[model samples]
Target: METLRQYRENLQKIYGKNDYWMVPIFRSLFSMTFLFFLSRYLQMTGKLGNPMVILSLGLLSFFLPFSFVPCLSGIFLLYYFYTQSILLLGVGALFFVFIFIIQSSVRGKYAILIAAMPLCFFFRIPYFLPLLMGLTMGLSAVISLDLGILVYYFLRYIREYKDKFSTGGDLVEQLDAFSGNLAPFIKNKELFLVLLLFTLAALAIFVIRNFSFNYSFETALAIGLCLESTAFILYPAVGMKMNLTGELLSFLLSAVLSIVALFFWHDADYRGTEFVQFEDDAYYYHVKAVPKKKA
Candidate 1:
């Protein structure tokens, strides 16, 4: 435990010392990954799919505000969609505008977390996201989580309909394609489950960990995993086909990853001997005492 704490402290110190350069490099890598995956998945590598251009954009992301990544990504997506379907591009544009509005409201504190939701979905470790957020965040993060889910589903809609959309077709055909892609939220059982499992579970875990009790974080984390496991049984009800063995293996992996994350991010937050209490409109807050970081 002593060795682990020292390691955590050293990692924190390293980050603090290097974050000036480190932040951009990490963001740049993420930008490149995002663009590459989008292009690869679409199987449409035009100028936007050029490796050199992607690298240049990554470098630019390092220099400019990270917001530039999403803007470029959005414009690129809209233009791509425009080639496929103008009405579809219009829908993407609206989503883009709404995201910017929400981004401004949240001050982008959880932007990385939110942006990572789809990536998590792609990597099949989406179960890790809510628990990590619940461990470190407050209710304000709900917006970020919701936005992330929105982006995930929006991209899914694009993928599902891309083959069906008309680049130049009769108005009736375009409308038909657009309307089908705009499937009702209630019809998407997975969406409902995600809200219940990830969003609500995270909020519940947040509340549980903040309670005045022993081992609250552990309890909360355990319960979060339990909730996740319960979701497997719900797959059939949600109209989702399941591969039981594969899912079981994924659960084990997600559980291990979640625990590791808890260690690296949460447990490292060692506390001093003081307890503090504060409150907001919705709930009271109990802050664990800790030595302040060095100046």
Candidate 2:
């Protein structure tokens, strides 16, 4: 424990001394990574195949606030829809507008949930998003996460069924078909299972973190992972096909990343050794108080 405390103190000192530039660098790196993958996904889908556009988006993401990344992504989706069909673009616009409103509202703070949703498809670790948000954010973040999930699935549906859509149909007919298809997608048992599992995991983590206990963060993470793993196992038994190996690997990576992030957050907020000096009659005394690091 003493060694661990010393290590944390050392980390705190280093971070405190160099965090200003380090933060932006890290943020830019994350943005670049996200954009690189996003562009790759687009290319793979044959949606936006232009390498230059992908490069431009990657550059744009590096400079844009993290909050804007999702919006830019939504725009890119819209552009893709436009290339496919005007009717598809119209549907995309409606979805984007709705999401935009929700994001711009007080819940906007949780918009990262939306941005992280698509990444889940590629890098399964993103499934930890709800758990992380639940641990750190208010209950409303769950709603943001749900909407984000819906958006991801919706976009995926469009991509997969684009060929089946009738471009010559009347507007109302097209919308009806779209709505009919979306209703089933939204009610998909697999989708609901994932949503329920993540929501419960997040809530559980939130509850555990609030308990007055040592190693609360670690405990919460363990509990969350257990819940996630259980769901993954049971879902397969119940007839939901999933890549178990990929999900397990993702969970492991996400857990490590979350732990590191938690450490950084805790250290950043730490107030180092407090001391007091007092003089008494016939004696002069100095006292020091050192705060213990929470496990």
Candidate 3:
């Protein structure tokens, strides 16, 4: 525990010193990574998908606010959809407009979860979403995460159906068939399972972490991972096939990583905790303060 606390202090010192350049460098890498995955997922090896082009665009992203990365991703997505069909591109446009409306309204913290969702899904390490978002960003992060998951599955199902639907049929008929098929996809057990598990687990962790108690964050992470693991373990009973052993192993790995993240992001000294009471002209206040550990 002391080692972890010391490491976090050293990390903060380094970040404080280099943040001016480090943030942009990290942002560039994140943008490039997102585009790289976008290329592979969309199977675009053209100019837009070129590594040099991706690197250039990523460098440009360093000058833009981090929020711009999502717009950048959407533009890339829309272009990919354009390569597929004019109609498809229109659908993607409307989808982005809808997402923009919601994202603008809430304007939650850790907006990058919108991108992280698809990225983690692609990497098959989605088990960390609940604990990561809940512990770090609280319940509001779940909204962004939900959007990301929807984008991932939406793109996934659309790609699977694109070839089947784009057989040069009547335009209206194709649209009708596309919208019609979405029902079953919407009802997909896998989609619902992801939504349910992530929502509940994140919410649970958010609530637990807010409690004023010793080891609240650690307890929250443990319980959240247990809940998530249990849900995945019972997927077979729900008639959804999954590799039980593989899922368990993934959960275990995610749990270890979540612990590491929690230690760095949230650690306190209960021994240094203080309770105080003060009376002002208006009212009296009772306070409990737990100081975060530092080197």
Q: Among these predicted structures, which one has the highest TM-score? A: 3
Task: Quantify all predictions' global Cα lDDT against the true fold.
Answer: 0.76, 0.70, 0.82
| Per-residue lDDT of model 2, residues 162-276, tens digit only | 6545667776887677777776576677777777788888888888877645567668878887877777677878888777787778878877777766664443212555567
Instruction: Select the stronger candidate by TM-score from 1 and 3.
Output: 3
Once all C-alphas are superposed, what RMSD does model 2 give against the true structure?
A: 6.3
TM-score of 2: 0.75
Which segments of model 3 are wrong by more than 4 Å?
165-170
Clash count for each candidate, listed in order shown? 0, 0, 0
Write the number of the candidate with greater TM-score, choosing between 1 and 2.
1
Candidate 3 local accuracy as lDDT?
0.82
Instruction: Name the weakest run of 10 consecutive residues (lDDT summed) in model 1.
Output: 286-295
Best by lDDT, which number?
A: 3
Worst 10 residues of 2 by lDDT: 264-273
Name every residue pair that clashes in candidate 2: none
Regions of model 1 farther than 4 Å from truth: 1-3, 184-186, 268-295
